[model samples]
Target: MKTFEARLKPLMIAGLDGEAQAWRAFLQLLRPALHAYFNRRQFQGDADVEDLVQDALLAIHAKRETWRRADPVTSWCFTIARYKLIDHLRKSGRAKLVPLVDDHVLLNDGVEDGAVRQDLAKLLEATPPRQRRLIEDVKLSGYSLAEAGERLGMTEGAAKVSLHRAMKTLMKRVADREH
Candidate 1:
């Protein structure tokens, strides 16, 4: 392990000159400690803590101007790295804290709405032009069948029949593809 003064002096001076070599030296000094810090504290599967450490070091390098030269380098480096680790924990869904409750409440939420919309878009791709137009007018755009009938120049019953048949055909096609 590199001694604190040996590790810090070069970086502090090189950082003054905004030299990349100083940035590299600083990261090498900090990485091992940051790794051990994360490993000892956070659970595994938090997206490779070493990567987070490197990210923190890079961020420190990028934001090096913010540091006061009078400040001790180790404290400044660890503080930045600690904040980065906390940020990673929050983003990775590992930092949430909820109150304990006696009553268990569960909701049966189905597939995500975004996923359903994507499936609908895919279904529309395979739909015939008339069916696609009718679905857009009635289901999607919220047009009444009577209005749709007038637009298609067909009777209300004929419009309903065509729309129903088109929906059934689409369902069958989607079902067949799934199977």
Candidate 2:
């Protein structure tokens, strides 16, 4: 019985060299290890674990070119897996694990209105001038996109694109802050 590294190295190299069969076999071999890795992390259910395994595998495949032959394949693979797990935890709103004893204390006070306004202003300040105005008019003022665009001297389509980009940037900033 060969060690996992011995078995995987050849397949990984072959896969990188564009061997279709070797690539398929490599993924098949990785699935069980990936499944076990996620299961040990106590994911919500088998479905979540399986989903993460697939995500890790896809990431590994996509980033294959970045892998150096001199590095331990397992380390590279697990790094990708760890990132996928973190992304899943963040997107699922489970990145932070609160203790049961602290639950009551955590719920004591809601966010202050002033704090929310300050945070909103901070996020808006990072946007470009045009996008800032579009966000303010369309979102904060509750104006229709067309109305906001008319007020800002832009077409409705332009306003929509600007707002979408601004919102995406804000979301990324918030996600980064959370992590």
Candidate 3:
């Protein structure tokens, strides 16, 4: 948000200029905002959320000098928060982070449908049948999560977890292939 650029940018600029008090103030203020960001994202627990907040804050501090003066401070801070979250998910051996791709991703891509479907089939081959169905319905077939869940007789939350696991399985297969 431009408001973040307006408010936090000055504090960061001052801190970069060797103004200790302003730097401390920036950290103090950024802490809560980062906390809220992690709290919303953390799937494990409160302690983990707190740990992630600390991690992001430390990363932000360590990289303060790299901040582009023209960029939004909040954007830079939240980028660190997102990476911390992805790292936590990876180290915890949980599912890969859900992608932010649009639901209609298949519609716009120029790739031929046959090739795409073949690739999708290969990637999804090892996934469980129900999970494969869920992935097809939600990710490829243009169904809402709730709709897919309903079709499969799963609760929405269960569907979400299942979809996450299916994607994780696909990612593992891809990684194994690359190696």
Which candidate has the top score in lDDT?
2
lDDT for each residue of candidate 3 in 1-179, tens digit (9 for 90 to 100): 34544667788999999999999998888888777666655466789888888888899899998878876566577666666777777787887553333233357541122233444667778788999999999987879989999999999999999999888878777666533
- TM-scores for the candidates: 0.46, 0.54, 0.54
Give candidate 3's TM-score. 0.54
TM value for model 2: 0.54
For model 1, residues 1-179, the per-residue Cα lDDT tens digits are 66564567568768678787776776776677667655645556556677787787788778778877765566566557656765765677774332111011112211122223445667788888777888778876679998887788888898899899988877687555533
lDDT per prediction? 0.64, 0.74, 0.73
Prediction RMSDs, each to the true structure? 18.3, 16.1, 11.9
Show where candidate 1 strays beyond 4 Å. 1-6, 96-179
Q: In candidate 3, where is summed lDDT lowest over 10 consecutive residues? A: 109-118
Clashing pairs in 2: none
Task: Point out the worst 10-residue segment of candidate 2 by lDDT.
Answer: 98-107
- Model 2 lDDT tens row, 21-137: 998998898788778766767777899998999999999999999989986676578657766877888788885541111222223321122223445677778888888888788
Off by over 4 Å in 3: 99-179
